[model samples]
Target: MSGSGNVHLRQMARQDVAAGMELVQAAGWNQTEADWNRFLDANSEGCFVAEAESTVCGTAATIIYGHQLAWIGMVLVHPDMRGRGIGTRLLRSAVEYLESRGPLVIKLDATPQGRPVYQRLGFEPEYEIERWKLTATPSLHSAPGAIPLDDDKPDIEDVIALDAEAFGASRSALLHSVHRDAPEFTAAISAEGRLLGYTFGRHGLHADHLGPWVAEDQEIARRLLETFLDRSTGRCLIVDCVKAHPFAATLLGSAGFEFSRPLTRMVRRAVQSGRRSGLVCAILGPEFG
Candidate 1:
C-alpha cells in the first residue's frame, strides 16, 4: 500500500465492488456490479482503490491483452474528493503496474475532463471515438442471417480470430466473459460458411451497450446491430464507434442514433504498425479497449 497525505492506495478487493459502483454511479457512468467483477476477475493485482480515513474515495483498473497491449479504465474519484490528487495517484499506480508487466502499449479512452491529466502523464491522442445512442421499441423478430454464438458453433474460434485481428490483440478471455454475461445479445453473421462479422452486447446499468462490433463491411455491421436491437427492444442502446471508420458514423446516423459524447483514444507509447485494423466498427467499450 502507498499513501498520499490522508489518502492511501491498495489493491482492490471484491468487497470494494459496492463502493466502486457508488463512485461510477455518482459520475453517471453505465458500469454495473458485474463490470466491477469483470475487472477484478481479469486482473485483481492491477486494480487499485484509494481510501481516505479507511473509506474508498478513488479507483482505477487495468487489463493486459497479452504482452502487446494493456488498458486502464474505471478511473473514478468521488465528487467530494476531486481536487485532492487522488485520481492522479490512482492513475499512476495503474500505470506503474502495467509498465511492470512490460506491455508494448498502454491505452485509455479519455473524457474531456480527464484528457489533460492523461496528456500530462505522457499519453498522446491516437483517434476520436464517439458514443451514439438509439432509443426504440424492441423488434419482435430477429434479423435474418444473424446467428447466435454457441460453444458448439464451429465458427466460434473464427470469431475470436477475427476479433483479435480487428482489436490488435488476443482478448479471447474478455470476449468469452462477455458472451457468458449476455448470451442472448451476442450474434454473428456468416455466409458461404465464412464469418462476415460479429458483435457482443452488455446490459449496462442504464442502457444496452453494443461493441467490439466488427465486420468486413457496413452491411454486415448493420445486420449485427439490428440483431442486438431486436434482442434488447425498448431499451436505450449505446455504441462507442471509431470516428475514423468509413461507414460507422454514417450507418449509425441513418439508423437514428444520436451523438451522445466524445472520447479521445490515447496511448502511452507509439503504436506498432499492423497492430490494428479497420474492421473494428465499434470498440468493446472505453473500459475494455
Candidate 2:
C-alpha cells in the first residue's frame, strides 16, 4: 500500500466511506456515506475501495440481488488516480466475484464517459432512461385503491416471494439487508388482497430515490406513485423502466419528473437463463442498474 506499490483493490472498510465520498463527489455523483452503507449491507464484503500508501483512492460496489442479477455501481477513481488501471481492475474484480456466486446477468448503469469501457467488456445496451425531477410539491395525490404503507415492519416473506418472482432468483439475505432501513414501502392492491403492484423505498438508505413502482393496473400504479411522493420529501423521484412498466414511466413524466441524469441499462448475459423478459420488471434496485 505504498505510492510506488502496485494497485491493491480490495473490500472497503467503514473508514473508506469518507475518502470514497470525496472521490464520488469530485466525480460529480452524489454518493454519500449512507449510500455506501446500504451498498455494503446489501452484499456484505462486495463494496470495494482502492488505496495507495494509506490514502483511499478509488471506490466501486457490486450488488448481487435476487440471486441471478449482479450490478456494478458507484465506480469512481480519484482525479489523481485516473491514469492508472485502478478503475478497470476494480470493476473486473467485482465481476469475477459475482460470477463465482453462480450464473449471473451482469449489468451496470454507465455514465457517458464510462459507457465505452463497459461496451468493450461485452455488455450490450438494453435501454436508456432519463432521471426525472418534480418541479413543485403537488398535494398528496391518492386514489381509493392505493394501499397504505404496511407492516411497520418490512414484509420479508412477501417481499422475498415478490422480489424473487420479479427478479427470477432467490436472495433473501441480500433482501434482508435492504429491509433494515426502508422508510416507505407500498404495495398496490385491489379491493381484495391480491398483489397488484408494489414499490419499496429507503431514505438515508442507499438508492435513496425510491422506485420499481409497479401495479397490475396502470392507473393503480399512478395512484400509488402519488401516495409515494406525497409521503416523501425530495424535489423529485427517480425510476428505471423496461417495456413492461410503460405506464409507470408515463405517470412520473406527467407528475413533473425531470431528468437529472439519464443512464443506459446494459447487461452481459454471462450466465445462462431460460429467458430474460420475465425478470425484467423485478430488477428493482438502482444499484443493480
Predicted model with the maximum lDDT = 1
Give the Cα lDDT of each candidate: 0.85, 0.63
Where does candidate 1 clash, by residue pair?
138-233, 138-234, 212-283, 212-284
For residues 224-261, write the lDDT of model 1, one tens digit per residue. Answer: 77777667745788999999999988878866788999
What TM-scores do the predictions have? 0.92, 0.80
Q: Which runs of model 2 end up more than 4 angstroms from their true locations? A: 1-6, 42-45, 139-156, 204-208, 234-236, 270-285
Clashing pairs in 2: 1-53, 131-259, 132-258, 133-257, 133-258
- Give, for candidate 2, the lowest lDDT window spanning 10 residues: 274-283
Which residue runs of candidate 1 sit more than 4 Å off their true CA positions?
Answer: 1-5, 136-154
